[model samples]
Target chain A: MSMKRLESRTALVTGGSRGIGAAIVRRLWSEGAKVHFTYRAAEDQAREVIASCGGAVSASALDVTDAVACEAVVDEATEKLGGLDIVVNNAGIIRDGLFLSMEDTDWAEVIETNLGGVFRICRAACRQMLMQGGGSIVNVSSIVGELGGVGQANYAASKGALNALTRSLAAELGPKGVRVNAVAPGMVRTDMTGAVRAVAAEKILERIPLGRFAEPEEIASAVAFLASDDAKYLTGQVVTVDGGLSLLGRR
Target chain B: MQNEKSDILKTVTTVIAQALKVDEAQVQPGSSLIRDLGAESIDFLDIVFRLEKAFKIKIPKGELFPEKLLTDARFVQEGKVTAAGLEELKKRLSGADWTQFEKNPQVSSLGDLFTVGMIVEYLSGKLAATNR
Candidate 1:
C-alpha cells in the first residue's frame, strides 16, 4: 500500500458534524490523518461521521464559545491523537438580521462563537505547536466577511475579524514554524443555505459565474491542500472558493 | 559567594540577550526587559524557554512574571497596578529595585519592572531553592 498524504499526522476540526466541516474531517481522515472532530449539538451526526471514516476518526461535543472548554478540547485532542499537526477552526454561528434590528445578544453570540472561539483555540493550539516546532491552522472564513451580506452583519463582522486574526497570527507564529491561512467559502450547498436556496435559487445562481453551488467536498479539498505539506510555503492568504461570486463586484 | 552571584547575573544576561536578539552590552542590569530590551509578550515565552534550557531549571508561568496579578481587581485598579500590586511585586521580586515601578504604577508600565537584574535574582532564587 502506498503511503497516504497525511500518514502519521493528527488533525482536529471544530464543528465537523455536517457541511463543509464534516467534509474536511472525512477528507483529512481519508488522507490517513488521525482525526478528532467537535460538534455542538449533533451527537448522532458526529458519531456517524466517525463510523464512516472507519480508521482513527473520533468525535467530541464542544462549545467553542467557552474559553476553558476550547483549551481543554485542544489539550484532549493533542493527547489522544498523539500530536496535533493540523487544526481547522470551522466552528461558527450565523445570526442574520439588519444591523439596526440585530440584538446585542445576537451580535455577541456570533462574535463570541465565530471570532473569539478561534482566538481561544488558536492560542491553546499554538502553545503546543510551538513546543513541537511546527503546525498548520486553517480558519473557515466566509465571503460575506469580504463582500458583506445584507442580512448578515454579525456574521460578516465575525468572519472579517477572523481573516485579520488569521493574517496576524500567521505573521507572529511563522518564525516559530507554524502556518495560518483562511478559506472564504461562498454559496455552499449546506443545510443552512438550503432554506435561502429555496427562496432565491436563481437569483443566487446568477451571481456565481460557475453557474452552480459548490459541494461541501470542494471546499474541503481546498482545506486539505492548505493543511498538507504541498502548501508548506503558503501562509496569511485567504483562498476564496466562491465560484467567482466575489469577482462580480457589488452585484 | 559574590563571584557566584555575578556569574549567575552574566549567564542570565547572556541568555536574555540571545533570546531577544540584542547585544550582551545592551542588556544592562537596570535595563527593563520590555522598554529597554524590546521584549514583547511572545518574546517572553521565547526568553523563558531559552532561560530554562540555559539554566537547566523549570520556570512555571505566573511564577517569574505573575500573570495572575494582572487580572486581580485588587492588584489592578483604574487600569493600573495599585499600591497593593506593587507590594506583591516587591515580595515576588525582592532582589531588584522597585523605586521606578512605584513612581509609575500604571499597569502598562508593569513590564518595565522586569529588569535584567530581576530575572537574574528570580533564576538565582529558583536555582538556590532547587539545590537546597
Candidate 2:
C-alpha cells in the first residue's frame, strides 16, 4: 500500500550502509520517518545512502559489539531524532564454517555482535520507550536461523536465540506499549550472502518456490510494516519473508 | 514517631496513587494494592519504578515483592503458609496485621499483606536508615 504509515516517526536503523539495511533506511525515510542510520566502516557507502535520501536521513559510526557504544549511539539517536519511536536491529555478522571445524572466535564473535548487540541496543531503547509509554522494535533475523544452514551454525544459533529474546521481551514489554518482532529473510541478494550464493545459486534457487532470491527492498518492506502503526496489533512474531522456502522443509 | 509515620504515609499514598492511577483518597493505609487498587503483575513493576524514584532509593528486584517467596517449601505447604512461613513473615514484614492472617494464612492471601501500610512501613525503615 502507498501510505505514509510512519509519517513523522523517529527511527534508528543499524548497519544501514548497504543491502538490506540500506533498503530499510530508504524505505522508512520514504514513508516519512526522520531516519538516523549507523555504519561501522562503509563511510563511502553510508554517504551514498544519505545522498539517496537527498540528505534527509542522517547517520553516525557505531560498532554494535561495544556495549557502551550501543548505549551511547541509542542515546544520541534518541536525542538527535527528538524521540526514538522505532528501532530496527539489522546489524549482524556471519562466520561460516562447519560446526566441527568452527573456531571459538567464530562462535563468540558472531554471538557477540549478532545477539549481544541486539540485547544492548534493545535494553537502552526500551528504557526510552518505557518512559515514552510505547515504541516498536524490529529485529532482522535470517531464515537460516530457523532452517539451520550446514556452515552457519554460529549464525543460526545467534539468530535462534534472538528470536526467543524477541518473543520473551514482547511479552514483558507489551503491557508497557512496546512491541518486539523479527523479520527472517531468506537468501537475500547481499554481500553477506554472496560467498555462499555463488557456489550454490542453482541449488538454492530450486529450493525456493518463487524461483528467485529476494531483493533487499522485499525485506525492507517487511521491516517497515512491523515498525509502523500498520502492524500495531502484531508483536512477538518472527514473520519469515522467504518466498515460501520454509514450507518446503528444513535443510 | 506518630507524626513522622503520618508524613511517610502521605508521600507513599501519592506515589501509589500515581502508579496505580487511583485517587489519593482511595489509596488508604489498609487498602490492598491488588484487591482494592486493581493492580496486576505489570503494575507491580510500575509501582516499584515509581517507588524508587519517589523515595530516591534503590529497590532490587524481589525485595519488595518476591514473586517466588510463597512457592518456597520452608515458607509454604499445600497452598498454606507454614508455621515457619508465619515466623518468617513476622520478622520480614512489620506492616501486616498477622492476627487476621493467622486465622487462615492461605498463600493466595499473601498478596493481601502487601498493603499500602506495608509499603509505608518498609519505606519508613529504608528512609530512616538512609537519613541516619
Candidate 3:
C-alpha cells in the first residue's frame, strides 16, 4: 500500500531459520529491507523462510563460533547486498541445566554461540558501518538474563553479558554515527520453546499478566522498530518485550 | 616531478585543513597535524577517508599510523614509546626525517610524529609504487 519504512535498506540477520529469528527476517523484509539471514543447520527451514518472504530476502549457513567464518559472512553480505545498514544479532543457543550440574562444555557452548558470536559479528559489521558512515545493531537478548532462571544459568549469563556488551558498544560507536540496542524478549512461542511451552504452559502463563505467550512476530516488531529511523535517538537501551512478565516482583 | 610533488602537498594541506577545521596557512610542511593544526585521535579517520577519496587510493590502516605498534610492549613502555619504538617507526616511515620524534617518543607525543610533510611523503610513495 503505502511506502515501507525500511525501503532500500539492507540488513543481515543471524539465526534466521525458524522461530524468532525467522520472524525477524520476515518483518524486516516486509518493511522493505533487503534481508540476508543466516542459519546453522536448518537448510529446509531456512529456504522456507526465504520463499515465504518473497522479496529481497536470502539465507546462508553460518557457524558464528568460527571467527574467520563470521568475518566472511559479514563481508559476503555487504558485497552481495551492496551495503550493510542494519545488523541483527539474533543467532543464539540455550543450554538449560542447574548451576551445579551444568557441564563446562554446556556453559562454553551457550556462551560462545550467544555472546561470543555477537562479539565477532558485531566487530566485523562495525568496520563496514564505520566506513559507510552509520548503521544500527539490534541484539536479541532474553528476560531470563535480567531475572535469572533456575535451570538457565548459562543462557541467562550469556544474555546478561550481551546486554552489557550492547551498552558498551553503544557508547563507543555512538560518536561514529552507529547505534547499538538490544531487545529482551519474555516468553515467545517459537519452535525452540515448543517443548517447554507444552510442559509448562499453565505455570508460565500464570506469571505473565498478558495471559498468553507472545508470538515470534511480536519480538520481530520490536527489533524492526529498534533498527528503523524511529529509534535514531535510542541507544544503549534494552527494550523488554515480555508482556509484563518481568514487571511482577518475585513471590 | 617537482610540480607533481607541490600539487600533492597542496592537496594534502587542503584535506588536513578541512578535516581539522583549521586555516590552510597553519597546515605547512613543517607543521605538526596534532600540535599545530589541533587534530585529535578521531580526526585521523576523517582525514584518511578524505585523502582516500581525493587521491582515489586506498590507505591501509596501520601503514600510515602504525596504530598496532602502540599495543606492542616492545614499542611502548610506561606510557611512553621506547627508543626501539621510535626506531621501528623510522623503519616504517623511512621517507620522513625523524630527528624531533627520536628526541621525544612519549606516547602522547606519537601524534606529533604525524606531520603534513609525512602524509605528503607517504602519499607520494604510495602513488609512485602504484605507478611502478
Top candidate on DockQ is 3
Candidate 2, superposed: residue stretches over 4 Å from native: A1-3, A39-69, A249-251, B1-26, B53-57, B68-105, B120-132
Residue A188 deviation, candidate 1, in Å?
0.4
> lDDT, candidate 1, residue A161?
96
Candidate 2 docks at the CAPRI level of incorrect
DockQ of each: 0.16, 0.21, 0.24
What are the per-residue Cα lDDT tens digits for candidate 3 across B16-116? 87767678988899888778887666568767877887888999888887888999999899988888887888888766776776676678877777889
TM-score for predicted model 3 compared with the true structure: 0.84
lDDT of 3: 0.89
**Poorest stretch of ten by lDDT in candidate 3 chain B:** B94-103
- Residue B76 of model 1 has an lDDT of 94
Docking class of 1: incorrect
Give the per-residue lDDT digits (tens) of candidate 1, residues A1-251: 99999899999999999999999999999998999999999998998888889745888899998889999999999999999999999998887888999999999999999999999999989877866678999999999889898889999999999999999999998877899999999999998788779998999899889999999999999999999999999999999998998888475
lDDT of every model, 2 decimals: 0.89, 0.90, 0.89
Question: Counting only residues 3 or more apart in sequence or on different chains, how many pairs clash (N, Cα, C under 3 Å) in candidate 3?
Answer: 0
Q: Which regions of candidate 1 fall more than 4 Å away from where they truly are? A: B1-41, B46-132
lDDT (tens digit, per residue) of candidate 1 on B30-91:
89999998887777787777677677788888778787888999889888888788788788
Please provide, for model 3 over A1-251, each residue's C-alpha lDDT reduced to its tens digit, 9 standing for 90 to 100. Answer: 78799999999999999899999999999999999999999999998998898745887899999999999999999988999999999999887878999999999999999999999999989877866778999999999889998889999999999999999999988877789999999989987777778989999999899989999999999999999999999999999999999987355
Residue A149 shift from truth in candidate 1, angstroms: 0.6
User: DockQ rank, highest first?
Assistant: 3, 2, 1
